[model samples]
Each structure stands twice: as structure tokens, then as C-alpha cells.
Target: MPTPNKPDFQPVLIVAGPTASGKSALALDMANTFDGVVINADSMQVYKELRVLSARPDDGELARAPHRLYGVLSGAEACSAGKWREMAMAEIAECHAKGKLPIITGGTGMYLNALTAGIAPIPDVPMRIRETVTAELAEMGHVAFFDKLKRDDPETAAKLDGNNTQRMIRAAEVFAHTGRGLASWHNEPVLTPPENMFFKKLCYMPPRDILYDRCNRRFDLMIAQGALDEVRDLIALNLPPTAPVMKAVGVRELSSYLSGTTDLETARDLSQRETRRYAKRQLTWFRHQMTDKEIIDTQYSESLADKLRHDINQFLLTTPK
Candidate 1:
């Protein structure tokens, strides 16, 4: 396979879609064809403890192509979008220096948005403020805390799901520390992307029924591949509930089963349902948030690659270098 002609600025290929939509497979194929480096954009896949649950590229897949930013962090550490963007930017630059295309693949919309669209440079809230807000949330409960957030930062509160404790706490902390609503900071001018770099975006939007079925089957495969044991070991670490890894799709459901609070079948059913719902949410996000991408309406396969070959080649070979 021929490498892309050296361009003046980096050209990144982004393969984005809902979970179980085969983004990794497509990215691996593109890497082999274009002498590219496959870089992870998924939040969960970054955690070292979530191999099966995150559907991270298996050993065979990893060996077939160069990959970056996968399984680089411990589950105990929270990977905010800013943190991931910093890491991904380093990987992307390294790929460019090595004369390899950077193919970023994942389902995490926030991480993708941070990379491609830029994000607000909101100042970090003090740890003291974060702890205070968390304590208040614990004391007042989600309902009361959310009501307080509505009064204090209605713009942010209105956009959030009241049940999302982490976001609620974050909103409250931002307001407490800065005396400004989180939404206001978001509306501020954000860190801009590099002026010369270009992105070629591809998004998969498979039929809902087919996508849902795939989600179900994929969860079953996760179980067969030791997702339960993975969760067991993760739980043994006793990471805080607020840790992002603890909120992965199957983690809670499987944890319940591991603790003997639910049967394996019941846990599996709930996990599958949650996975489907998560996929639906992802589809909605990409549909509305990333309207500029080239949308492929089917799940990835060899035929899909064949179909996209000419267009991708045009992008790599014909674009300015």
C-alpha cells in the first residue's frame, strides 16, 4: 500500500459511529491501506481495565496495525475530554512526523468534538470546591442538588439529565468556583484547531433494527470473552462510583450480577438493553452534532470498504500535498 504524499499539514481520517458499528475494523482496514496509525477516540477504550467491555481491538487486531491511546490509563483515573484531547494530539503529531495517516476511530462524541470542533478553555475548579459540591450532592440528594443547579445555572441545568450525578456536580462546582454558569463558559470563544490541518470525517448510521441486533449480539460476545470477570476485577479495585470507568455500559449491570443481586440472565438482558439505548443516543448525537461528515448508512464490511475506496483514495492522493 502506498503512503499518502507528504502534505504541508496533517490530514486526519475520522471513523465515528455508535458502539458495535465496526468502527475499529474499518479503521484497521484503512490503516493497512494507507500506512496509517489507528488512534482511539473512545473514552472507555482508554481504560486499561475495560478490554472486553469496551470492545477494544483484540491482540490480533492490534498486531495487524499500529494503534495509539488505547488502554493507556488506569480505571482509577478519570479521563476528561481535555485530557484525552491532549493525549490524542500528541499521538496525531507523532503519526504525522512518521509519515503515516492518522485514523481516529471511536464512538465518544465529546472526545471527537473536542478534537475537531475545539472546546472551551474553562478553568479547572478547585479540588476543595469539587469535594464540597460532591458532599452537598450527597447531603441534598440528586433531586435537591439539581434544583439548586437550576437556580444557579439554569442554562447548564436545562441541558443536563437530572439523574446524571457527575455532570450535575460538575455544573455546580463550576458555578461555585467561577460565579459563572457552565453554559456561559461554553459560549466563550474556544481553543481553535490548527489552521493548516484538515479532517476527513466518516460516520456510520446503520438501520436501527440492524444496529440494535448487533448491540445485543456484541454484549453476548463480551460476556463470552470474560466481561464478567473483567468487571469483577474492576470492582475489586473499589474505584469511586463517580469514576467514568464505573459507568461503562455493562459495568453496573454486570456488577449487580457479580454481587449476587441479580441473576446472570437478568444482568445480561439489562446490559443489552442499556447498550441498545446507548447506541440510540450515539446515533442521535452524530445525526445532529456532526452533520458535515460523509454518512454511510450501513454497518462496515469489506463491500463497504470497496465502495468507499475511490472516495478515500481521492481524499489521500488528490488533496493538496
Candidate 2:
């Protein structure tokens, strides 16, 4: 393809990896080093109610550098990848205007892909259609709703798990309102980023054993940091079970404990296991979907940051080819 018009093109740096891979720390280091603004790309981190479970940057870390788009949404509102992309693009422009680099960081592959590769032009389903589909799914439950989705949009259903309540409802709403399967809409050309924006991607891929250990230890630390209280507050919101925040990795397991369905120890173990599984999936997605990025196969540390300085400096100074 012909090179995109180079004049005024802005460069963005991306720090992506699985949970507990230290991508956040790396982003903070980069922000302090490069006079950059760190923009949130993690879906959960955007919700105001999920700070503890989402492992969102704490006040001290936030004080180290400018951060944007973190904890900006209510858990009651769902944030789609396209929605996040819009918000992220605006933040990037703001950073560039202020003569600061934009450092995007997160483990949400879908959100990152939306920013880098763009997203399909899937129209928003009407509120009426969405409400109706959501109610129907709640009444029928996931298994039945998934079966209905299979009949209505088999291509989409085949790719989704029955337990992925939010996506299933989304698929149903799209099919009901548009008279076309969600999969078909995906086949349409995606709405990509402007040619004037370029991304320098970096992914962390810590060894599986170390990554899983970190996932387990992090949950323990979260509990110590009053994650149970966070879950309690979230439950008080009475958000629908399918609400995106409600489905965060620790929410369900911890909620089970609070509801007397499981003991604390069991909940803790299960939550840690789920966290590990989530990390594994994230690693797989980054490995496959972000193949053209620089890879760091070890955990982040001060030495790693020192080693990365030269490469990041080059990315900041050079124009995209």
C-alpha cells in the first residue's frame, strides 16, 4: 500500500500484555521518561466501580504521570470497543496537542485492536431492541438464549461461549434490529484509524509459570486491600448480572462468597484460577493478533526500562516508514 501522507502524522506508543505482567508499571515509567500521558485501554479499568478488582493505578502511581480515560465510566454503562476507541482517539489528540507522547496501556485485546486495526462498522442497536433482548435473555438464561442466538445468528453464536452473556445479548439485539446476523455485519469493511496516526506497539509475554504465579498473588493482595468491600459496594448497585463490570474476573467468585454460596477460601482459589485463565487468553490474543510488535518475554523492572530507553527514544524521534 502507498505510504500514508506523512505530514502532521502523530505517533502513539502502546504497552500491552496480560494481567499482572507489569505493563502498567512500564507505561508509568515511559510516561515519566517521555513526558507522555498514559491512556487506559483496559475495559474494566474504565469503570469507576472496578478500581480494586481492575487493578487500576492507585493515587501514587497516578501522581507520577498524567493519565487519561481511567475510571471515567459508571458500571451501569456498558463500554464497547468502538466506544473506547473514540475516547482513546480524543485523548491521543489531546496529548499530541500538548506536545506529549501518548502511551496506551492495557490487556484488553479487543480495545487495543479497535485502536490499532480499527473495528467493523456495527451500528448501534436501538434502545428498545436492546432492552427487549436483554430482558428476554435474563428470563431465558444463558443456555436458552445462546440456543436462540444459534438459530438467529449461528455464525456469531459459534464463536461465542454460552456464558458470554453481554455479547450474546448484543448479537441478538443486532440481529433483531438490523435483520442481519452480527457475523455478516462484521464482514463489512472496518472503520480504521486515520492515516495520520501511527502506532509503535510493544507486548509483554512473561513466562507462563511466572505470569500465573503473579495472577494468584495479586488476588491475595487485592483481598488484603479490601477487595471484598469493593465487591459489596458493587453488589449494592444491583447492576444486572450481565453488566460488563459484574463479569469482572473476581466479582463473580467474590460475590458468591458474599452471598453464602461459597466459602472465602474456595472463592479465593476459584478467583485466582479464573485470573490465570484470563491471563492465558490475553497472552494468546496478543501473540496472535499483535504479531508485528516488539516482544518482551520477561517481567518489567528498572533494568528492563533502562534497556528499553534507546528503542523507545528511536520510536519517538523517527517517523513511520
Q: Tell me each candidate's RMSD, in Å, in order.
A: 3.1, 4.0
For candidate 1, write residues 162-249 as lDDT tens digits. 9998789899998999999999999999876787677889998789999999999999999999999999999999877767889999
User: Candidates' lDDT values, in order?
Assistant: 0.88, 0.88
lDDT of 1: 0.88
Model 2, 104-152: lDDT tens per residue? 9999999999888889977766455676898998799888889999998
Off by over 4 Å in 1: 1-7, 123-132, 141-167, 175-184, 299-301
Clash count, one per candidate: 0, 0
How well does each candidate superpose onto the true structure, as a TM-score?
Answer: 0.88, 0.87
Question: Which pairs clash in the backbone of model 2?
Answer: none
Distance from true location, Cα of 265 in model 1, Å? 0.3
